[model samples]
Target: MGSKINDKRESLWQDRDVRFDVPLNELKLRNGERIVEYFSKIEDTKGNAGEEGKVTITNLRLIWQSKIKPRINLSVGLGCVSSLTNRTIHTKLRGKHEALYIMTKVNGTRYEFIFTQLDLELGTQFGIVQLISKVCRAYTSTKLFRDLKLRSAVITPNSKQLKVLSSETIYNKIDGVWNLSSDQGNLGTMHLTSVRVVWHANMNELFNISLPYIQISNIKVRESKFGVALVIESTDSSGGYVLGFRIDPSDRMNAVYSELINLFTIHSTKPDLGVDSYLEMGSSLAFNDHESNAALITTSDSDLKEIDDQHVAHQSDAIAAYLADEAQSKNNEIVYCPQLGLAIEKIKEGFTLESLWQVIPQG
Candidate 1:
């Protein structure tokens, strides 16, 4: 129960949000991070002419490194990326060709980067722009995993033909639903998408609520001034909103309520947080540091075995590296766990509650 989302901005930016001048040796997949796609023969237009670099799009961030000098690199987290666009910009590599423009804000400071396609044969059927756009969309849709949002524009604007999420499908829709948040309830259409329950005001589309099933603490039919209204209670982190809605025809309302309950139950079993990633059949998780093999290359069985061994060692190293960084930065403090209702140590990559318990001296 809170006011509509305002323009008040709050930042969660950290020192680790963006990194530059990264060493190529340090480029390894951390826990819960996977390479979605890789593009080579890409020119950093802002840099020198004919200076090509490789771009790796991961589940968490975008990494770009110079082909000739691997030490020159940039890593931008998706959390800080405000916009990604395709625009024609003048570059020494290719004159006035369409390039990928990324705008990001880290710690209240804005940064812009432009990268152009150097290899013409690497055309549009499956290009850098398309891949990055798809990955960015995947990240945006899966915000429930990161943080709680209220009255956000997470839904498609189309009212008639609602756009289904890549990992979600339409369940049902109820029209002529009245939201009882205001003194005079606003009539809107309620959509029961597989991922969330969305209700948008018919008059003002801006006034809407996208309650993801992950944040729903409870949903039941309750008696209110509107009489026989459906109530939804959100989790504490999500402002603990208790939303009420009314639908005409009592039986139909009951039916919709029952359907919602069933859908929530089914989704709870294996909830899709909207993260979609796919690596080709023979691709390796490791980044090939060789300049000659800048383009996408498939790995053989023998190569896979070698890569697996390296990956395990790299994962262990990565954990230690993160711990060292956390200690130096002094930012890894215990935070509140909304789900557990307790303040616990913030577990970094390659860590779990059980592992921490085993390591700690329990009295």
Candidate 2:
């Protein structure tokens, strides 16, 4: 029986052509945690020239095992990771190499880890980074709730509450920013979850804003003289306030708006479904209707008729142009152009109207 087991192990090693110091099953995992991906020959930024290892990313933690002599093992819990940043490094001989910088918290102390020479496509790296960031955000949010003793602050229908969907750094414009410096806005981190949008200012730990999705009546992206702004209209007990955030990169503002819209839609339709189930159902529904109206909008009218003989292509562009023209006439009215997701607010004094356009989903 011993000889038979040894022979089986040798055969398995020969088939795979690689030895794993720590197998996937051997790694410690929390309940519901699972491995997401594995990458080989990843070098730690602080290690020796020839030091390389295999890196494994689980839903709960990141594990690394050195491949060379003096084997080293390291693990970072996802809950401890604060952020992931990607950068390009230029070497005299190696030219340009992509690197990933991971910021984590250990025993309340912040640490940074850099991994170089990652053999991943740009798109794949981006997707993986985004997934890791999302997991970390959810973990951090749970930790925050626990630390603040506000686990019951969010009133959910079920036990599953405070599932973070996305989080990003944004600037909150001060009311009197026009009279202040250009960089006068408060820098803060924003977290969007299934239930609420939370903002924590870097300078003010005691001051934070949390607004539930139910209170948010409308969300709009607008152009300001200084930069792009996210306009959130809420009807909460504070007598309802319009909050504006000036987000950098403009694209992030759009993403936040889209996420809010999705949350609003899901909350309105399926309030009972938990975040995980809600996401799964949304994916299934989207996959099943792959050739729905959204697909038609992307293809040209001629191609649309060729693909679906029963369907006639609508002149969406023409309608958009007409809407734009009509909006120009109504200078006093704040019109929301469906074609362009912008709220056409009247240009107030001391503000310059910039020609910015973005495509919005057809209502």
Candidate 3:
């Protein structure tokens, strides 16, 4: 199931989940994605140790771009993250310093990333880590609002009350509803949360189901064996659970169905991932006063290329010099090959193909 689900969901993560050295246009926010916070001079120790960059925390993912070359960046989805912690690492730009270490799994491959704070004045290392941790926790805690759950315990057993979440708001509650899953339906109370719809049997509090807005492929009021019923068909990815509920008094049923439909539409347009980041300093970073927020973010990639150009340019020059020195020290010998059309440098005996790839940026 894990492999099949991962393979099926791979498209969702193909380009956006994990990316490196991508154009600025590619970093533009998705329909529902929002920037939570932004920090400058955050060095991706896992990528280029000497280069300082900006880190943008969003509801969906974490983005890091080099101040020198915005194209040199990384984006990791919140869904793919397995763990994150604070650790100390020695870097070329800064001598031993505390850094953010993140572990993630993408398409079955596990990866680790380290980010160090270069500017101590902006915020403490603990603050950044705690903020990210909170966001991730919120994302995990609110998965029920994004994914469909079958026969799940959405409410506390024996209590017959919904397990209210931090971001969840009960918009409506309807009593005397019948669950049409079986021939003799069970009476229950239906709950309308901000992002999901839930129903639990009054007799058996443990019998409950959760349907998130994202999973609702279709919703309609139609005739069933139990009379007029409101049916919700889930998306294929959610195992395609089709739930039905019957309510008396036609007017009340229509009102409830209309409300659900409206809420579902609103949620579909602007999804609530439930990940929020609060920073005392606000999210504004790396743009000039003359630049409008929407124009700077939505305009052509070139328009944002020169942000803090002077500072980044100086650092870029230094990095280029260091790379030049490193290359010279390698003592690569270019030789003409009979099998090949052009001259190629021979791989040194000590360096393997895997070792060579390690030097490449892995966001």
Candidate 4:
């Protein structure tokens, strides 16, 4: 079960009367298949007489380290903080059903031992909690397919020149006059679950219990290559201020860029790049071909080097570039799909990037 149990939300939560009881009949979920919901209700309550108000969150982490027979343990702790004032963090587990029903027809040998002990593996409340956790992992992974984690730093390139000022804080870092954005470092907490019951007929099928323990962890992402970098520093007997940023060339952005390049493809045989300069973070170069890629690398720990004239074949504009030598470059399975073409056009029009990322797949 590798999907999204809940999407990324800031201080959003919901509660339900779901039972943590295991060993039950075909359990039906009132809220449907989704086990958790995000941002159900956003509320702020003020405290009385200067007393800090208490808020209840739907997403809370509870750990049961060691368990004895007929004993249920649930320990709670804060995974993050969204408030600053007086905080009263609490954790409690309440049984949704009065009686724990056991199905006589269901057989044994259908459960997995807890992290270590088989004795603590099976129970009414604890077992159900484990199942819920497993379900959550599987559900979320399935919903959100894997994608590269921690897209671009989303900060000015100047900010990356120096690391975060402090290790503990996730705030803006100060480097003299430069405010390098803090690397909050994304938590690929992509709640993942890979069933490994090698002996079982199917991994999804929890043979022993209704719910099994699934692993949820922070994501390990791969670093993608950045775009080609060009250096054009003011030289000669004159000195001037320099400024530049980076071009992400992210997958989504590249897709649109390639689509647009296909337009008026016939007229430009050599190479011509028309760009309206807005932010002066980097030098712009007129490459000889649409299939150009550049990169700015550090000559050392204290210097900058630009990789120019790589002239290597790259994915600049797939559709149009793909037609560079073809009998007809724009005519193919791609252009035939009107819906997809329209979508690509919208991308060239520069749709709100922030809005599009909301639904973009994250690995």
Candidate 5:
């Protein structure tokens, strides 16, 4: 150790007491700071999803910074990835230690993605998340917004929480569960995120592709939670695919703080337009732009009274439905009776930390 190299060498930034496991409760984090979970509201596999439906999953990236900021460092091993599927898809842990790659485009105007869904048995199934651009994109092969839609839904109050997300807030319905991350930064932690979404045909697949790559040196399997994900999808100049990305220290090669400040962070949620009202006044705006904002319903109305009204009505419905179905769920899971408004009283009724070892090894 002759010529030393220590750039403000700080000890490992140990992030403890952070978990992402839901439904399973007693959330815990995993290596590389990855934690995940999955749940089925229906007593069985298929709930009320029927013919006119396509299974889908969505990941809503909530930037904790002042504005919706994406910290992406696109480099060699890790960069932005955009995955797309022409048809609706699902993801399933047919076996343990299985994984896939999804990408999204950072730019909003045009989005294209290539989703390589891993098929251990066959190979990888891929697709694209093409944008219709306007509300009519889905209306006609000749329409504007008919083809442009995000896998998101409103979180109603019936969720049985004190204050659920506002009515205007939109959450991407990520159909499948997160098995593990490419990196092991989130190892040994748990997260309990309660959410419900518009389930799609491909409930087993990851939806909403985005940029940012992580390096996975070791292939490890871990437990998951009921967590949400944000998938950013987009296209390149050649009509190919280019997923969106986050700033990763090990990913971006030409990362500039200035470009990130101008392009990624502030623009992620509320893009810097000449005028805020400009996007709202337009008819061809994206799904979120022209509509009521998901996160912020009305900054003027403090305490979110408006969003709460929407929440109250939905909560009442859920309560009524759960109460009506209480008897049916009593036989299966004592703790969680989705049919009934009342969830299990105890947090650690089913399993404990000691028992986790038993199932963890097998998965």
Candidate 6:
């Protein structure tokens, strides 16, 4: 029966290729895996910073193919992705464009896919972001279900109540180095579920901590002397204490913050309120009055002569210089609400949690 079901799923996957121009072989899908969602005009962060492309999210991985000449291809395993969130970008002709940011677990590499040259209808980008988030959550849940072991065969009544929202193998920075050696920081698995966030050290199960969302008053990401860290402020019967966990690869920090915020909002008393205020906050952060200085591309006389000789050096140099400057500037600027940090602040300000659910696209 399982084999028959798998065959049916494969057939269904093949049938869904009516919209895609690329062949299935090019996608290189694994057995029983299928593409769930795809979008055009997706700009990759690599190379030109905004290289136009098409991105497809499958059960196994995200595959992106560049639309420009000398096509660039890349794929990221779903298991490696920490989070997917919506980002707003300012473009020269387009004014403002909504982009999808994919943060990975390794070295916190962030890939931005911008929706350019495409007319996005109302709520389109929101739907896309929500779909991506759901997919990531599903992958994380599946992984946790497989890896976490239990001693007893019988399940407790409360076992079903704990729904894993997100799980990842995170290294808790004890020392500055994450070498996985005995003297280095401990490595462990972290899970954010319906009730609380749990971290169990791989070396010792007893060395663990669980913090309920209700008790959490504040959660912030800041640059510390050790590096980027997630500081969770909570209050208990004994009083208040801050729990700090250093997440390496730094980029994955936002995703962790966003997941906690999402779970917290879901468990709030009133989940259907505060949509407008959250949108207002996001817009306020996105609005930048100062226009960025555009780069001037001037061709020297020798370069023009080289161009006549069909030499590509001049064009390559110009592109390389522009990209370097763009990267440097981005590194210098502070990211706004890297995760749902802003949303958490609004929640503390007495705003209800309605907007978050409304903004994120559901499966």
Query: Which one wins on TM-score?
Result: 3
List TM-score per model, in order.
0.43, 0.35, 0.65, 0.14, 0.17, 0.36
**Displacement of the residue 214 alpha carbon in candidate 3, Å:** 3.6
Estimate, for each residue in 1-363, the C-alpha lDDT of model 5 and write its tens digit.
011111121211111111111111111111121101111110111111111111111111111101111111011000122222222223252222211212222322212221222322432121112221111121122111101223222122244221222111222222222222333212111111121112212232123221211110111111123222222222222123322122223223122223222233322233221111222344343223222222221112233223345445544443232122324434554466454557653323333333322221210
**Per-model lDDT:** 0.63, 0.44, 0.67, 0.19, 0.21, 0.44
Error of 5 at 340 (Å): 42
Q: Write the per-residue lDDT of candidate 4 for residues 103-215, one digit (tens) a residue.
A: 11102211111121122233333233233343233323321111111222222244332111111112122111110112321111111111100111111112111000111
Ranking by TM-score: 3, 1, 6, 2, 5, 4
Supply the global lDDT for candidate 2.
0.44
- Candidate 6 versus truth, CA RMSD in Å, comes to 20.6
Model 1 misplaced regions, further than 4 Å: 1-137, 141-160, 277-363
CA shift of 267, model 6, Å: 36
lDDT of 4: 0.19
Quote the positional error of residue 328 for candidate 6 in Å.
Answer: 8.0
lDDT of 6: 0.44
lDDT (tens digit, per residue) of candidate 1 on 202-228: 877668877777667778887888788
Q: Stretches of candidate 4 above 4 Å error?
A: 1-127, 139-148, 151-363
Instruction: Give the Cα-based TM-score of candidate 2 against the true structure.
Output: 0.35
Answer with 4 or 6, whichever has the higher lDDT: 6
User: What value of lDDT does candidate 1 attain over all alpha carbons?
Assistant: 0.63
TM-score of 4: 0.14
Residue clash pairs of candidate 1: none
The C-alpha stretches of model 2 lying farther than 4 A from their native spots are 1-26, 91-94, 121-127, 141-151, 156-363
- Error (Å) of candidate 6 at residue 128 is 2.0
**In order, what is each prediction's RMSD in angstroms?**
18.0, 27.4, 12.6, 31.1, 25.1, 20.6
